[model samples]
Target: MAKEYTVTPWEVHGDVDYNEIVKEFGTKEIDDSLLKKIEKYGKLHHFLRRKHFFAHRDLDIILKDYDKGKKFYLYTGRSPSGPIHLGHMIPWMFTKWLQDTFDAPLLFQIPDEEKFLFKNNLTMEESEKWATDNILDIIALGFDHKKTSIFKNTEYAKTMYPVAVEISKRITLSKAKAVFGYTNETNIGSIFYTAMQSVPAFLPSIREGEPTNCLIPYAIDQDPHFRITRDVAPKLGYPKPASINCKFLPSLKGDSKMSSSINETCIYAGDSPEEVSSKIRKYAFSGGRDTLKEHRKKGGNPNIDVAYQWLTYFEEDDKKLEQVYHAYKSGELLSGELKEICIETINKFLSTHQKARAKAESKVEKFMLRD
Candidate 1:
């Protein structure tokens, strides 16, 4: 029997099937018509074309508001249990594109309290440290300093708690358990954390005393949390936040999503070029035949190849990507060469990002949301 797969906000295991996940999550696929609608508002991002960001909720409605001169803000977050990995970058990269295209304000949350509640090894102090480190990475993405406001949930609790209480009133414990698979074993803080997550979606609207639409770009695993948020938005007289969901970036070992818990299977933002190359060369699961001669004869399967899959996210040029695809399928490009390409591409990205991250270290104060 095929191993059963599981996906949750706290844990992701087994290989995910995006098609099945979309159906299960009650999200609509981003179709051509919707793509055209989005293009009307802003440039169609390559992530949309490649289906990395494949599903959405109320995306059309958000655009409709934009057409009528109502603007939306961006909200997406990180749980700072550990250092961030390349997989963590996927949503933020797309978020940056959306921010630039729409010229939107962004609320970047580092939910350290959530991480502290969930991860056993992490203390509040440790989570705070990770949150600080994570903020540096977020700033490194080149978000507009003037419009971007970042806050660690614990640090800005004075501002976040009041709104979170209103959200908490609407969400029942039964609903939380059903959505998050919580049992009696779950702690009170963990249960209350969802309310904090929901606050950013409707926060700007609350502050503005008008309907400010929110667009949350995130992985599909996070859909359940926002589903609860959407449920309560109308009760509070705020518009339901719209979301664009992306598929999880595959692990180097060809398992489920790239995870911070599993160090060997993930490529971190801070990894040196040599470490990135070594990980890809040693750990990346290939879809080629065991023997080189056999691989040449039968060719490799890009569908199952980790290197090829990473390229979909990294390689933006359609023609160039197609060329690499054809070469691999025709046995003209060997596994080592493919790994080398992925390594080179990742290293190039890191070189620029690391420099930005270093600069961002000195600029963290500029992005924080104050009480």
Candidate 2:
């Protein structure tokens, strides 16, 4: 006879205080010294001057090497789980800027194997399509084809199995479990996912037979993965991959991170201008109260308002953003007017990306497959 299963109300329904999670894991602030250095290095435009990308490890060492004319490469990847959302763009765009500013070689990988393992029901054809779309979107972010290389794990695994095997051998199961929160109940494939990700960090050097170091710019949530990579780096005969942790880009619905699973929570790079406007208008959480009278007396809460924060990143014109902030604070502009600014800003941003994405789709494969 089959075993019986039981369910409880707590299992079916429960609420987590995500705000506490954000406070614990997401609070980051930048220093004046770093900002000065960024401006001096002509990186002010390249990097977002926000508190989110403040925490880092061994970044100063990379900067020292860069100062001495030593080359440092970039490594960042995506699992190809779904359509690439705005959250996905954070690292890619930042990497592109870093590559352009420092003239560093970059490796962008599509973790097809990991995606396949995690999402077992997804077909190979579907994986390929997602990878293709993601590559197009990434390339549209202004990565040079000659300077950037992309790897698809499923395709490369055939040729690079020996390297993968060697990497897997060096990482103990105990270490993997500790680093990734894996338990006995975790899938065997999930246990080895870290090795799959680590190999690409050392690939440029492996392929060239030269000493190589890498800098990964990624969201803070992904720091755990690279912490494992950094620990296993020396055992694999390479320098530990260094990383700069970026803050999570909040969702339209005010979550800490935007997820592709949530339809109304994010605006994608591929969204039509009209779609972009509609989503912002309909779903953007308002900081003001329902009554005009109460809103005029209380003033808007800039800290919790999604529209204001979106402007901080999207609105290039500082004067306009300042005007909106002042108006909202003084009750001169209502929530609808503020959302219009966000919609217009987002539409303009997406329009530029769409044109580039069209050209990118045709050439992205060749760029990824390059030697």
Candidate 3:
């Protein structure tokens, strides 16, 4: 939520090409072997078997526990830096899906404390507003309140100091530096970020006085924190947390990642239909050439096209998405036409989510203060 620079699609991969990441680690293509293994030992639902989630570390163990009627909770946190965006929904959506399918308890943590550390002047009013907004957005993703728990770190920290101390004692500054690329110059607040993250992973068990297992669905960028969490889990007398690392969602401008800080780089959940249409027409990157004749003669660069990639993730109608891709690649579809389709699709999605969010907001306290 920290207002960072919106990167372009070319910059999304840094030195690596986007397609290479897709080929190597992206779950665009489902592997039969992996599917068979999961089907044999884990839930073989479409979301898992179809590779909607691509990479995981030790998730099989959590699934194995589930198969045996043991419980493993889901843990995911957010930094309340800004209004929720499309990038913000990825983890929550996947987590909600997992909760529904596995019937697991889900814990959602709002790292308002982390945001406060990064922005020292952040007021309690601002923190509460951001936390409330984020909760509404997450609930709109269709999580059941009965199975889901939400916490604000500022609230949790009142009695969680002991757990923080325990986590800090288990991890060293040297180890944190190595894992998080922290230099001697790194802020002390940032250095302690790992312990804050670790506390929530273990808090349920500490409060319940019973061991709890946790699984996190998060972006790969956050892997470092949980790596430390896993290492600290055993020493704290709890099971190590499992994780499923999702691929980064690319920006509409074809830059690094879709960010809400730059209005042109992303379509927000609150965007009006006209705003969505205008942004897509004006800012969405096009793979087609300036001239239709030239575009027809040469194939399009699907990798650089933002609309195509966005469709890959958002469009529920697989056949229609494929048709759009085929038409665009073959030069039968114009960039404007494709952009129009994306705008409509996104607008429809946002409209539904906004309505759902209103209902969710009414019951926010019920989930937040739950045992």
Top-lDDT candidate index: 1
Per-candidate TM-score against the hidden true structure? 0.97, 0.88, 0.87
How displaced is residue 350 in candidate 2, in Å?
Answer: 0.7
What is each predicted model's overall lDDT from 0 to 1?
A: 0.90, 0.73, 0.74
Q: Which parts of model 2 are misplaced by more than 4 Å?
A: 1-30
Please rank every candidate by TM-score, starting with the best. Answer: 1, 2, 3
Q: On residues 225-317, what C-alpha lDDT tens digit does candidate 3 reach at each position?
A: 777888999998988887776666677788766766688888877777888888889989888888978877774655578887777667767
lDDT of 1 by residue, 172-242 (tens): 99999999989999999999999999999988988899888999999988888999999999988999999
Top-scoring candidate (TM-score):
1
Q: Any idea what lDDT model 1 has?
A: 0.90
Model 1 lowest lDDT segment of ten: 1-10
Candidate 2 lDDT by residue in tens digits, 132-206: 778888888889888888888877776456777878888888887666667677789877777777777778778
Q: Between candidates 1 and 3, which one is better according to TM-score?
A: 1
